[model samples]
Target: MIKVGIVGGTGYTGVELLRLLANHPSVEVQVITSRSEEGIAVADMFPNLRGHFDLCFTVPDVDRLAECDVVFFATPHGVAMSMAPDLIRRGVRVIDLGADFRIKDVSLWSQWYKLEHTCPDLVEMAVYGLPEVNRQQITDAQLIACPGCYPTATQLGFLPLLEQGLIDHRRLIADCKSGVSGAGRGASVGALLCETSESMKAYAVAGHRHLPEIRQGLSEAAGRPVGLTFVPHLTPMIRGIHSTLYATLKDPKDGLQSLFEERYKDEPFVDVMPEGSHPETRSVKGANTCRISVFRPQNDDTVVVLSVIDNLVKGAAGQAVQNMNIMFGLDEASGLGIVGLMP
Candidate 1:
């Protein structure tokens, strides 16, 4: 069994990790840390985990974490970088679900995240944990930086077009909307029910942190720097991301559907829906899946792709588990064999 430790077990992503890892046949969740909630039973804090986990929350301890085969940092950005170096030296694989090591360029990461990177050297060694793009790298990585929720949906929507050199990379646009739960399990005036409910608005229009991460991935795929306008909105729901991507087609082709279908045919998590289909975020709720659809309206030069995923599942915890599966040579779908929760 792969011994797993999760740091910061109180947040949405952290608890989500617990919910999924609890069922993984090959995984044993040994350590779950939460500095503020030390000694509190994990199930007491989150009733959803009452039966699955009988562990109590402990303070973040490097020694205990390093003893595990893999440590998943579901904490904020800076939290992982500070502890990762020690854990990595102890031969423990580190997977960060935050933005600590996702961007290769430390300066760019610092610019957006507004904090200096503690382990810039490790940033170079950290692999972006998007199985569809970096499956091979993730398998051998000592440090895996899981992609953000928005980047996951947006990148998957645009990857096939960019990789095939079929779209104009300069004018790419990702108009994405996410549920309130994406804001994290924090007490905030903006995230309050009275504030977010019955309302939809965009934030980070100037430049969201995920912009650089998305551009970095697409640029690497396109073999050239790509320009993207990424705007994120907060919806009234609880757990999902819907990204409507737009790009100009270099040529009006007939096989766009084939291109997407063929690109994700072998990928276990990415579902390329039928042509003219619009993927809904609820379709992927509680499941680690990205449902995608490709379209070229009126046979114009513009191609639109719709991608949906549960922000906490495929976006954070589920994808983190997927990376752990690859790192440990287990089946990629080992712990994530769950269907979306639909009504």
Candidate 2:
């Protein structure tokens, strides 16, 4: 069995990892650290994991983490970079669920995160863990940099159009809405029930951190630098992301639906819905699936694509587990065979 260690088990993503791994036949949770919640039973903190894990939160120790086959850093940005280097040298694979090694340029990452990157050299080798695009790289990578939630939904929505060079890459717009859980488990005045419910507003219009990451991925697919306008919003719900993407069709492709279907035909988690069908966020709640649909309203040049995913599932922990499955050569769908939670 693949031994796994999770750093920072108190947060949403950390516990989410344990929740999924609990049923994974090929993996075992060996260590889970939380300096703040040390000595507390993990199940006691997150009752949802009551019967799954008998482990407790402990302080992060490199020796203990290095003993595992792979270490998942579900902590804040800086925490992973500081500790990943040591664990990596000990032959332990490192997968960062934070933005520590996502952006290739150290300076750009520093600018967005407001902290100097402690281990910039590792950035070059950290394979971006987007299974749809970088599955091959992720299979043999020593370090994995999982994509952000907004980026995952937005990129999946725009990838087909950009890949075929059928759209105006220079005039792309992604208006995304995410639930409060994307803000993390921290105590934030903006994330309170009274503060966020019955309210919706777009933030980071000028520039969001995920902007660069999205641009980089699209630019790579388009084979040129892409000009994009990405705007993200905070929705009232607590578990999903809905991305409405717009782009001008430069080539006026004949089979847009077929194109999207063909591209993701072999991908396990990407579901390209039938023509004219709208994918809903709740349809993928608690499931590691990105449901998408394409539209060409008015038979005009402007094409619209809608994408939805559970912000905490396909957008975060679920995707992280998917990457782990690939890294260990197990069934890609193992432990991820989850159904959507509907009301």
Candidate 3:
């Protein structure tokens, strides 16, 4: 069994990781850390995991974490960079579900995250953990940078078109809406039930942090820097992301559907819905799957694609587990055969 240690188990992502890894056939949760919640039983904090995990939250210790085969940092951005270097030196593989190692350019990452990176070398060495885009790199990487919820949904929705050159890379628009859980489990007035319910409004139009990450991935796929207008909104729901993307068709590509189908035919998690279908966020809720469908209304020069994912699943913890599976040579679906929850 792969012995696993998790840092910062107080947030939504951390708990979600515990929930998924508990059922993994080849995984054993060895240590979990939380400065504030130290000594508390995992079940006391999350009732859903009552019987599965008998472990308790403890304060983080590098020596203890280094003993595990792999360590997952479910903490915020700066936390991982501060500690991951030590773990990696001790021969432990590291996976960060934060913004620390996701961006290649250290300066840009600092500007957006407002924290100077402590390990620029690791930033360059870390593999962007989008399994569909960098599966091979992940298998050999000691440090994996998992993509954020917005970047995951956005990049998957745009990759097929950009790779096939079916759309004008110079012009792209991503209008996305996400559940409040994307805000994390922190205490904030903006995330209060009264504040978010019965209303929806876009935030960070001036340029969100995920903009550069998305651009970096899209640019990599298109083989050049691409222009993208990414706008994100907070919906009243609990846990999903719906990305509606737009692009100008380069020339009436007849096989856009076939292109997408072929591109993701063998992918275990990305499901390409039939042409003209509109995928629903609820259909992918709690599952590590991105269901996508394409449309060309009136056969016009414009193309629209709808993509949906459970933000906490394919968007965060579940994706981290998928990367872990690849890194350890385990079946990609080892503990991730989750059926989406429906109403």
Candidate 3 per-residue lDDT over residues 211-299, each given as its tens digit: 99999999999999999999999999999999999999979756778888999999999999998899999999999999999888888
* TM-scores of all predicted structures: 0.99, 0.99, 0.99
Candidate 1's C-alpha runs over 4 A off are none
lDDT of 2 by residue, 1-343 (tens): 9999999888888888898999998998999999999999988999888998999899999999999999999988899999999999999999899999999989999999999999888999999999999999999999999999999999999998888889988999999999999999999999999999999999999999999998988898899999999999999999899999999998665699999999999999999999999999999999999999999998888999999998888888899999999998989999999999987
Q: Write one digit per residue (lDDT tens) for candidate 1, span 1-343.
A: 8899999999999999999998899988999999899999999999888889989999999999988999999998899999999999999999999999999999999999999988899999999999999999999999999999999999999999999999998999999999999989889999999999899999999999899999999999999999999999999999999999999999897999999999999999999998788889888999999999999999999999999999999999999999999999999999899999877
Predictions in order: lDDT = 0.94, 0.93, 0.95
Model 1: how far residue 56 lies from native, Å: 0.8
Off by over 4 Å in 2: none
Per-prediction count of colliding residue pairs?
0, 0, 0
Clashing pairs in 3: none
Model 3 backbone overlap count = 0
Candidate 1 residue 336 Cα shift, in angstroms, is 0.5
- What is candidate 1's CA lDDT for residue 326? 95
Model 3, runs deviating above 4 Å: none
Poorest lDDT segment (10 consecutive residues) of candidate 2: 250-259
For model 1 the local lDDT of residue 47 reads: 89
